[model samples]
Target: MYSAFKIGKKFLHYYFTAANGKGHGVHSPFVFDLITKVLNDTTNHPAYTEVEEQRRLLLQNETVLTVEDFGAGSTKGLTKQRVVKQIAATSLKPKKYAQLLFRLVNYFQPKQILELGTSLGITTAYLAKANTNAVVTTMEGSAAIAAVAQEQFDALQLKNVNADTGNFDETLPELISKPESAFDFVFIDGNHRKEPTLRYFEQLLAKAINDTVFVFDDIHWSAEMEEAWEELKQHPQVTLTIDLFFIGLVFLRKEQKEREHFVIRF
Candidate 1:
């Protein structure tokens, strides 16, 4: 009962804290345009429908599994013993976030992509569909979820996506240390703690291209996450950031001298 109450409180806090329309009086032309286009995109695409169908299917399967959490679990009292269907139903990607990622992957056509979390691989599939030639490396801390996602990838024939199951903190360092370590697009959705998020941000900065795009999930999930978002936005290399409450999009465009930030309502 206390866990339920805490979740309710967190939801209310987030709902009330979010800035309404006009994105807190944002002034950047590019950000404003991005807000109007990506965040506020109302039309449903075919890809979104496919993803939604898959999500529904995952939710219907009442299979139970033991989950290995590499980061802090958002839910209270969550243990290794949990229902697979429950996780799929309660922890899949939001529609707004899915659309945002779809648009980003479609627009940028990034040759290489790195995703921190592959919870069921819904977001990974969405990103892979955008550019077939794009190599998408999605890391999952749980072998159980990774197994399910790998099956999904096989059924979808998404050959470009590589769903690797392991401890991200340990694997990321080894991967980044390699000579060919560079990613055009990155999504950070693993660790929700401020320190780990900041550490990952700093470590990934070394592999960033001048025009790399980094997307962080659950930026407003907690005060610490929000603080991490703020710190990341203020980084010297970051020139643009778009806050959609749930996700924070970062851009490192060297061509732009001034930094721009926007809060768009979806």
Candidate 2:
């Protein structure tokens, strides 16, 4: 409890400082261009409209469904009374994140994409649209939510998306054991708990390609999450890590010699 408070305070301080253009002051050329082109570049695109439309659809669904939460539930939403609208609103992947995911996926054009959480398929939709040739496998814990997401995917004609509904503890292991399991992009948005996050990272590390990019959401969510992100950044395989307050991105590039970690404003 106390640690969460401290993290929240520090996050607020960072937020104010970042907004003033004081952050990312003459960082790596690569990261500087990324910040200017991706983060600071607030140019709205047609895809953003698509994400907003999906958000509207999700928000309009007043239907309530039981949520099978595998991770810590931060909301007052009990496992019983989980409204679709509430979940849409309370979820971590806000509009900004959806936009970022869309832009990143489009830019990276990763052949294989893996998403840890498939909440209403908002992020999944963005990824699917970004790379039509890419095969997207999204895992969702709640059967009801997963069903709804699958329906949304079909309705949108997003043929690349495959929604898997099950307890990730078993599903992830089985997927990792598969013979052809190489992922160029991985989004770690599920199971926000510290130990589980680290465990998942270690387990999936084998599947990453040389140019793999991993994005972990809510690094400043709590002290434990921050610690987990920091430890992940220090991993031998991780050559670069970018801390954008809301998300921490990891890049495993063999060409980069020195380990680099940057905290840039987005």
Clashes of each: 0, 0
What are the per-residue Cα lDDT tens digits for candidate 1 across 124-147? 989998788999999988888888
Return model 1's CA RMSD, one decimal: 3.3
lDDT to native, each model? 0.80, 0.81
Question: What would the per-residue lDDT of candidate 2 be over residues 111-206, giving only the tens digit for each residue?
Answer: 999999898888898889888899999998878889878877876779898778777888999888998988999998887878988998898888
Query: Among these predicted structures, which one has the highest TM-score?
Result: 2
Q: How big is the positional error of residue 165 in model 1, measured in Å on the Cα after superposition?
A: 1.4
What are the clashing pairs of model 2? none
Once model 2 is optimally superposed onto the true structure by TM-score, how far is the C-alpha of residue 175 displaced, in angstroms? Answer: 0.9
Clashing pairs in 1: none
| Candidate 2 accuracy as lDDT | 0.81
